[model samples]
Target: MSGDAVLDLAREGIWVMIIIGAPVMVVGLLVGVVIALFQALTQIQEMTLVFVPKILAIFVTLLLSLPFMGAILSGYMARIADMIVTGG
Candidate 1:
């Protein structure tokens, strides 16, 4: 393919990656900030307190978001397949 085509594909790949990862990252960030604030307020300062909840929250968020993520990836793959079939 031409350089422009390659670059377009690369850009789409990067955006797809970002779209897939954004939910998990955002959830984890929000949870971390809340946990940090709680720790600050209560002065608990326990390391596990911070990690366990964030991990669990992220896992749950991932589970909930799996269908949407799958759909996005599947759509991208389908597009790529179509492009290949069309010799683009």
Candidate 2:
């Protein structure tokens, strides 16, 4: 394939990755922020306090978003497969 085609594929792959990962990341970020705020207010400076909630929130978000993520990934895979088949 040409350089342009390769670059386009790379760009699309990156976008797909971002899209698929956004939900869990966003959840983690939000949970971490809230936990930080709570810790600050309560003066509970425990290092481990930051991890569990963020992990649980991210995990729940991942579980909830699994189908959507899967669909996006499958679509991307299909597009890549098509591009390969059609000799992009």
Candidate 3:
């Protein structure tokens, strides 16, 4: 592949990675902030308090987003395969 094509592919790979990870990251951040606020308000200060809910929320978000994520990845893979077949 030409250098430009390689760079473009690399850029696309990074974009796809970010797109796939964004939802989980956002959910984790929100859950963590909410948990932190609750702990602050309730004065719980439990070290592990944020983990469970964050994990659960992330897990559920992943579950709910699985289909959409799969479609995106599948489309990316198809494009990669086409590039390979075309010797791009």
Cα misplacement distance, residue 73 of candidate 3 (Å): 0.8
lDDT of 1 at 3: 84
lDDT of 3 by residue, 38-77 (tens): 9999999899888899999999999999998999889988
Evaluated against the true structure, the overall lDDT of model 2 is 0.92
Q: Is candidate 1 or candidate 3 better by TM-score?
A: 3
- Say which prediction, candidate 2 or candidate 3, comes out ahead on TM-score: 3
Quick one: ranking by TM-score, best first?
Answer: 3, 2, 1
Per-residue error at 71 for model 3, in Å? 0.8
Off by over 4 Å in 1: none
Residue pairs in candidate 3 whose N, alpha carbon or C atoms collide under 3 angstroms: none
Q: Judge candidate 1 at residue 45 and give its lDDT.
A: 80
Error of 1 at 42 (Å): 0.9
RMSD of each: 0.9, 0.8, 0.7
Give per-residue lDDT, candidate 2, residue 62: 84
Model 2: how far residue 76 lies from native, Å: 0.7
* Backbone clash numbers for all candidates listed: 0, 0, 0
